[model samples]
Structures are given as C-alpha cells and as structure tokens.
Target: MVEAARILFGEHGFHGTGMAQIADASGIRVGQIYRDFESKEDIIAAMVAADLSDFLDEAVLAQAIAMGDRQRVRRWVLDLMIRKQQPNDSTLLPEILAEASRNPRVAAIMREGDQRIRRHVAAALAMLAPHAESACARCVEELMMTLMMGGCSRRMALVEGDWQFLEGCMARFLDQQIAWLADHDDGAAAADHADA
Candidate 1:
C-alpha cells in the first residue's frame, strides 16, 4: 500500500491522488489500509521512513568524507543518488517538495529529513575542520546541502556512462571548497558577505 501510495502520489500530486487510487493500485482493501494507517498522511510518512532506511547510510557518508577522497566519496554518494532514482525518484521528489510547500505534515517530514542531512554534513565538516566553530561548521553544512540538493534533481536523471566528467568536477570543486573552508577561521567572511 505504501509503495502504491508513493507511485500514485508521484504520478498525481498529493492533492490529486485519492485513497481509492492507492487501494486499487496496491490491491489492498480500503478497510485494511485504514486499519493499518490512520490516514493518507500516515502512509506517506511510512513511505518516507522506508525510503530513508534504504537510501541513506550516514555512517558510510561520514567515513567517506573523513577519508578526504573527494573524487571517490562524492562519486560514491552520487552513484547512490542516481541508483535510487532508477525508475522515478527524480520526478517523485519534486512532486513531494511541491506538495510539501502546502501540506504541513509533508513539510514537517521534509524538514526533519533536511535537518538529519544537515547534522550529517556538520559531522563531516567537524571531521575535516577541527578548529571550526560550531556556527561556521553549520553554515558550510547548510551551503553544501543546498548546492548538492539543487544539483541532485538533474544529476540523477543523467547517469551517463561512468560519469567521469561529473566525477572530476565534483572532486575539484569539493577539494577547493574544503580547502577554502579550512583556511577561513569561522566562515565569518562568507557570513558577512551574505548579510549584504
């Protein structure tokens, strides 16, 4: 039922999908579904939890970042994202995001996921830049998450052979960015610039 809900919600926006549609697709009775989940929101919540359990391994990500092999680690992460988007993730995510803007339940879920990633990124930054202030580390974490998330929607869609070009770019950019962060005391300059 959850899988059906994911597909239906992706195909038809959250508002467009009906509980009957999910029941029909999953071949589950509406009564049974209702017994399991109180509402459509609950089903979607379960779907998100299932996705997170299978999709992200924060420990592996942290280890990869700690190793400082930007090329390899970034590619590893990219490969995972691309693989996750295999059939229809790219489309599904955008649909959810659009719906989340209007739905408080969805919004809360998305925010929680975002904060989880932010915490992961902050941990990675702390591994790299030991001298970093918590505030500065947080700022870099947010920036990395923003840029990465913005690029992900399309990058996953184009999983061309080997992704060699993309790999090099990701490595070079990450290397430079990490070095810049290392040199800065607390991202104070970047923060200052953003204020203007």
Candidate 2:
C-alpha cells in the first residue's frame, strides 16, 4: 500500500492522491488499508520512514568516515549527487517537501532525516580535525551540506540532469576539506610521535 501511495503521490501529489486510488494501485481493499493504517497522515509518515531507512545508514557511513578514507567519503557523495538520475526508485521527494511546508508531521520526518546526515558530517569533523568544535569547521560543513542538497534538488528537477557537474563540485570540495583534515591528522601524528 505504501509503495503504491509513493507512486501515486509522486504522480498526483499528496492532495490529488486518494485512499481509494492507493487501494486500487496496491490491489488491496480499502477496508483492509483502513484497518492497517490509522489515517492518511499515518500512512504518509510510514512511507517517509520506510524510504529513509534505505536512504543512508549513518552508522555505516560514520564508520567509514572515521577511518579517514577519502575515497569512501567521495564515493558516497558521488552516489548522492546522482541518485535522482537513476532509473529505478523514482523518489517522491519534491512532493514530500511540498507537504512538509504545511504539515508538521512531514516536516519533523524530513528534519530527522536531514539531522542524521548532519550528525555524520559533524562526526567526520570530529574525527578529522583537532578544532572540529570551532565555529569555522561548523560554518564550512554547513555550507558544504547546503550546497550538496541544492545540487540534489537541481538534479531532481531535470529529466537527465548533469550529475557529473555536481560530482566534480563535490570532488573539489572534498579535496579541499580532506587536505585540511589530513593536515590536522599529520599535526596530531607529529605531536604523538614527539611525545613518544
């Protein structure tokens, strides 16, 4: 039912989609769908949750980021920049974001999803920089993530958008950030060696 709603919602937007239509798409009876879900809001929340579950597992990415693997981080960012262009799994993101403006529940779900990514960014900062807690690091990370999301939004707007442009932008951004991180790591290593 949720999958059917995702497709319908993507096609028709939230307001245009109806429970009966979702039932028809899923081949499930409306009565059963009502029994399964509390309300339309509940169904919407569940759909967002299920989508976010596969979106990004921060636990795994955080592990990779902490290990100072630049390629790992780059690959993840590259994947993100191009995700909307992929043939399968057409996202209902624009519709979701539209609903989020007026729907507190949807807004909260979106916030939770963005928060997870932000936490990973913060964690990576902590791992790579001696001054991760400083204002400068916070500012740079915020700028980077905001731009990354903008690139994602742009990609979704086009039928065959240029993923390579975003990828290149991210590559340069990562190179600059990673160089700073490496410098911090090197300084910390030198300090440890001197102490030894």
Candidate 3:
C-alpha cells in the first residue's frame, strides 16, 4: 500500500491522490487500506519513517564509531550528505513538502524526522571533532541539511545534467568541510598534548 501510495503521490500531488487510487494500484481493498492506515497522513508518516531508516542506517555509523575508524566514519558522513535521489523520490518529496505546509500532522512528522537526522549528523560531526563546540557542529549540520534538501529540490526542477554538476560541487564542498573538521580536531589534540 505504501509503495502504491508513493507512486501515486509522485505522479499526483498529495491532495490529488485518493484512497481508491492507492487501493487500485496496490490491488488491495479500500476497507483494508483504511483499516491499516488511519488516514493519508498516517501513510505519509510511514513513508517518512521508512526513508529515515534506509537513509540513516544507524548500525553502520555505530559500528564505525565502535571500531574507532575515523576515516570510515568520515566516509559514511560524506555518503549521507551526497546520496542520490531516486526518480520517485524526486517527485514524491516535493508533494510531501507541499502537503506538510498545510497539514499540522504531516508537518510534525517531518519535524520528527528532521530531528532524527540532526541527531545522526551531530554524532558524525562529533566523531570528526570531539572537542568542537556543539554550536559549531550544529551550524555544520544545518548547512549539510540545507545542501541536501536544496539538491533534492534542484533535481525536481532541473534536467539530469544540470543538477549533476551542482551535485558534484556540493559533494566537494562537504568533503572539504569534513576534512577540515578532522584536521582541526587533530590540531587541537596536538596543542593540548604540547601544553601538557
């Protein structure tokens, strides 16, 4: 049902899609669909949760951290920042965002997902810069999030080649920031040791 809704929502805006359309696409009965999902907002929430699970994959980050592999963690962070959007996602996300603006429940769901993302980004940043101020890490987190969302929006608006060029530029920018954070943290540690 969720997959069906994702397709429908991508083709048509959130308001344009109906339960019957989802049921038809999924080959499920409308009654069963309603029984499973309280409302369209619930379905959207589920979609957001699923995407978050796939995107964050916290186990990967946790394992890297546990292994004390700074380079591995750095690579994971860069991968997260520059993930490519699926063709479906390119359209579906904008529809979700448009609905979120009008529906408080949808907006709340999006907010919760955003918070989860922020926490994950913060953890990655901490690995890069253990001594960095929380405020500084947060600034970087916001910048990364903005770049990600802007990339999605650009994909939705532009042709493939146009966005790919901008994407490469953003990826390079994120790579540089990650490298600087790691270097800065190493420098700070050296200074502290020298003082000791």
Off by over 4 Å in 3: 159-172, 175-196
lDDT of 1 by residue, 1-196 (tens): 8888888887887878888899999999999999999987787778777776566676677667768755545554444433334365766788778868899998998888777666666665665665666666667666677666756666546644555665566567656656766777556655867999
Residue-level lDDT of model 3, residues 3-67, one tens digit each, is 99999999988989999999999999999999999999999999999999898878999998889
Scored against the true structure, residue 7 in model 3 reaches a CA lDDT of 94
Best by TM-score: 3
Superposed model 2: Cα runs more than 4 Å off: 65-70, 85-91, 159-161, 180-196
Clashing residue pairs found in predicted model 3: none
Model 2: pairs clashing at backbone N, Cα or C within 3 Å:
none
Ranking of models by TM-score: 3, 2, 1
Query: lDDT for model 1, on a 0 to 1 scale?
Result: 0.69
lDDT of 3: 0.82
TM-score: the better of candidates 2 and 3: 3
- In the range 77-118, model 2's lDDT, one tens digit per residue, is 555434443332345777778889999987887888788667
The regions of model 1 sitting more than 4 angstroms off are: 62-86, 155-163, 185-196
Residue-pair clashes per candidate: 0, 0, 0
Q: Which prediction has more favorable lDDT, 1 or 3?
A: 3
Q: How high is each candidate's TM-score?
A: 0.76, 0.76, 0.85
